[model samples]
Target: MAPSSDAAADGEPSGDVMTYHLKAEHELRIEVDFDRQVTVKLLSGDAEIFGCELPKGGAKTLSGVKCAIFTWHAAQIQIVGKPDACYEAEASAAMRSYLNLHTALEERRKAAVTTTSPTTKGPRVLVVGNTDAGKSTVCKILCSYACRADAMHGGVAAAAGHDHWVPVFVDLDVGQNSVTPPGTICAVPVDAPVDPVDGWPGEAPLVYYFGHASPGENAAHYKALVESMARVLAQRETDDVLARAAGLVVNTMGWTDGLGYDLLLHAISALSIDIVAVIDHDKLTAQLKAHVGSQGGDVQVVKLPKSGGVVTRDTNFRKRARDRMIRSYFYGSRSELNPCASAIDASSFKVFRVGGGARAPNTALPLGATSRMDPLRVAPLPMTRDLERCVLGVLHGDNAALGDADVLSKPCAGIVCVTEVDASRGKVHILQPSPGSLPSKLLLSGTMRWND
Candidate 1:
């Protein structure tokens, strides 16, 4: 609902500040332009952004984002600076369903605490839907809810020989990842509420470089990466009882047709996902249900409604968001990071691209059969001027004896961008976020590029 003329007049042309009074179960959604900033402060009562509780009287400065400030009870909020759009919405229905689902998952976690069966595990939930359906928002809400539960009952759980509830958030959406930068898939343990401004923390995240915005660019490689992430998660759950009980909340890309659909099924099986939450998409829900029924597995497919507060972003907006994400990795979201720029000998390390090599010649193939390239092939790329402005994933572990298989399965320590390739000097100048030497000599290349 638009603020009345009286409310708009009080601040619009004067101080450029506006006050919004929201009733219970209502939300104020605002979309801040990429070039602007908006400061949000909770004036009175209780409210939260996504699932993170907003600090009373504290201001959160946000830019280039579209978010909702939801209040479970009546509240007053103040906004400074003009956003592209702002409105109030009644979000009781969608929020209620989300809370109910969280409650059900919580019950399972409680049961897992006392269960002796080795086969028993917490809810391995997967969220799937079309583009702009609020899949990532749902993931954040669930993770935050789980973390809040842990904060309240962690001491009790610890007393009973259980660790704090730390839900693993697996993000398979390379286009707009939650934890890491774009063109990467990662899983991070969430034990605290995700900050509305800063998002998920970067502490000890298991990251893999997928090298492209969409999985369709290399479906085989993407599936392989998914399997690798699942393997690591399985091992973690087996070793930690609390983590096993706390379970996982997986976020996937918005692609949900053809190859996208096939990849979803593969992820469900590889991750042993038990709960498939489909948001506001009946066709996807029905397809998943039928497939699950035919396979006769323990997977539960549930339909969820998308929040009305979600604003649809155009292609240009998404591109700008991706660019900002990459930039934030080096400069920090608030320009608090001082990325080191240094030059290293080209021969000191190696760069490799996966699955883009040339196919075998027709003469080498059998008659009447076509030659096809191996999508998993590891091809070494030469250091040259062409590598300038390219983003590279710094692979972890021993690069001394890396092989094709290791390249596909190995996780990255971090990422760097090639600023300049000095061919005459045989040096590669790179921009690194931290002021440390490269962890390994193995670097992976993708199609992502950044100039600044």
Candidate 2:
């Protein structure tokens, strides 16, 4: 059905509300304008937007949501916001290309089963692009389509008592990670369709904390985490038939210049990516083509169009997004989690910084010699005032004598946000995931600090 526009009256003051009625098997697609916001609510009947289920009588506010399609068997929705543009299209052409890619992978997966050596794997795709280029959206679409295909083929695989059907999703974008909380790189198995709106559910993904919001904060640390994740994924693919057949779809950060480009190359090499999908950047696409060709490897570089509906976010918006991610971690997206708040003695804990607060230039250090300070050094904190309002990573390792490099390499059990710090009393107030004492007293600090 066509959308009907109405000016807000009485209780509704925005005056930009539009209502749409959808029949069975119909969809209403929307593309919010650049730098604008949209609020969508299910008015009646059963409806869902993306993978997230809309509350029966609640509304969801979307900021910088580029393009979203709401589908339902029979339902009505009231959208009280203006969009840059909105249209009804069955599917974009880029989606068709993605499907073709999936088809090719499926053929490879089947061929691998017939080969004498079952070590042959499907395509390992790495999606890279600048900010707001719809990298995440493309990853979701690819993952969802792959999951659907797996479901169709699962019955036969199940009859054989082989259950390795789900594809693996590696979230390397710590800035806006979909599988786990922010400041973490995760690897999750996707056996079912991903919620388009909510992305991946908060699954217990294999996580490694980078302890910073941006890659530029500690490039060495970020690259180290990437290598660690790559090693884990490689081992899984080797050991698990399903994972091997499914391969990996790695979603990366939007940093495509200078050190960002260097980090990207590091990831590409470490993951041994077979396909590099560059979204809407000619320079980056060309660079990857040359780099991969120069390396004498059979890596395919394909260019994908950026959706017109992608919204560009400013600095403030990104900060808010980070804050929301942290909040969602402790409280959950629907406020379903009840985290515990506790106070502890500051003297009992030791806070360490990773990568030694970024590296200095080679010129700054003496020739043929490095700085005395180590990049992974985990020096002790004096329980000073700077500890207040900072987010500290709860280390997974129990060894208190672990060196700085060892501590930086270890994954975190969870995170705690410091609320207050009292030097005289040696008491530190923190918001933690559970009550009682923390898992470990070896807390690692980074440049990331949160107020709420």
Candidate 3:
């Protein structure tokens, strides 16, 4: 049966509390209003947002999330709070194409096993599109399908004693990373379906901090991180048979013009990508085909239609998303993690900024010198009020002997958000993931700051 809605008559506006009864294989698409919050709960049956399953009888609040709640079987759900639009839609044709691609990859994986190939190369998919083009969604679906295939084929357990067949998910979009905190590039191993609402659970992702929200802001640093991630993925593929057969699903940022285009090309070469799926843009597809063809690389450029469910997000919405990601890092998606918030003497820790606080304009720089600053240059920052509310990356290296460049190049152990800066008492209160003294006194500061 199709969903039947019932609104309350208690003087509140309609849709303030609405019930939906979704038939099997139906989805409830919610396009949330700008700057509005929506709360949804599974009243009966089973439904999921993204990869995360909804609680059996509990509610999940989404602020600035435009998503589809889908179920393979019949389910009913109740939604409170306001939404700009709400409707039901069957799975699109693009989803079918994605599944077909997965089927082909599965065949290749099986063939490799049968032939006993030394170097098994499965599908290395790279997803690229403009902002809000649903690149991440495509990647998520592909990863989920791969996980499901593993489970069905008895890939869950290995003859050599392993837990599951883990596929590598390389998140190159540092600003909106699915596997780790914002401002960091991560390569996560996904063995199961991701949480539909909560995203990739706080797994142990290999992260490389880029120290900025946008790749354009720190192009050199971003490129370096991408290279690092690609190397990591390459090494993992060589070492693990399941990982090599499962291959990689790389998610890129939505900067498809000029330098962004160049960065995409760089990633293609660096990752040795075999398939490039260009979403919803004919021009981008043409450009990628031409570029890849000219280079004589064995890359298949495929154009994918954008989903009707994809909601275009504006600047404010993007900012809110970033903030939410940062908050989710420390507090978790369900606010279940108890992050430590304590005041420490400012003199106890040394804070440093990377890339000399952004590059100076060519006109402002000395004659004959390039405008771009050294990406690995780190400068010590004096404790001040400006440092308050800034996110600081706790470095893994020792503070004493490391040079400026070494400091910027090192990966961070964790991060802390400055809550208060007490100059009078020389103390700074910070919110961190755990209690007690920090692992390292050397902290790396960046342009990325989270108000929450």
Query: By lDDT, who's the top model here?
Result: 1
- Which TM-score value belongs to model 1? 0.94
TM-score of 3: 0.85
Question: How do the residues 1-452 of candidate 1 rate in per-residue lDDT, one tens digit apiece?
Answer: 44532243332333367788999999999999889888888879999998999989888988999999999988888887788888899999999999999999998887775687767898999999999999999999999998888522435367645445789999999999978989999999987878989999779999999888988888889999999989999999888777788899999999899989999999999999999999999999999999999999989999999999877889999898888998899999999999999998999989999987445678888998887688899889999998999999999876567789999999989999999999999999999998868998899998888879
Cα misplacement distance, residue 93 of candidate 3 (Å): 1.3
* 319: Cα error in model 1, Å: 1.1
For model 1, what is the alpha-carbon lDDT of residue 136?
90
Evaluate all candidate structures by whole-model CA lDDT and list the values in order: 0.88, 0.74, 0.77
Candidate 3, lDDT over the whole model: 0.77
Off by over 4 Å in 1: 1-15, 150-156, 159-164, 357-372
Model 1: number of clashes? 0
TM-score: which candidate is best? 1
Per-candidate TM-scores read: 0.94, 0.83, 0.85
Model 2, 1-452: lDDT tens per residue? 78888777566538488888777645566755335667777888776553335666577666545555545366777878777666543434555565576677677666554445666777788999998788887777677666656432434356545544467888888888877667888888876667645568556677887777788887777888788778878888777656676778889999999988998899888988888999999999999999988999988999887755466777886777788778878887656889888889987888887755656667798789776655655667777888888888887777777876677667777889998887788889999977888888888787678877
Deviation in Å, model 3, residue 47 alpha carbon: 6.3
- Using lDDT as the measure, name the better of candidate 1 and candidate 3: 1
Task: In candidate 3, list every pair of residues with a backbone clash.
Answer: 49-196, 50-196, 51-195, 51-196, 52-195, 52-196
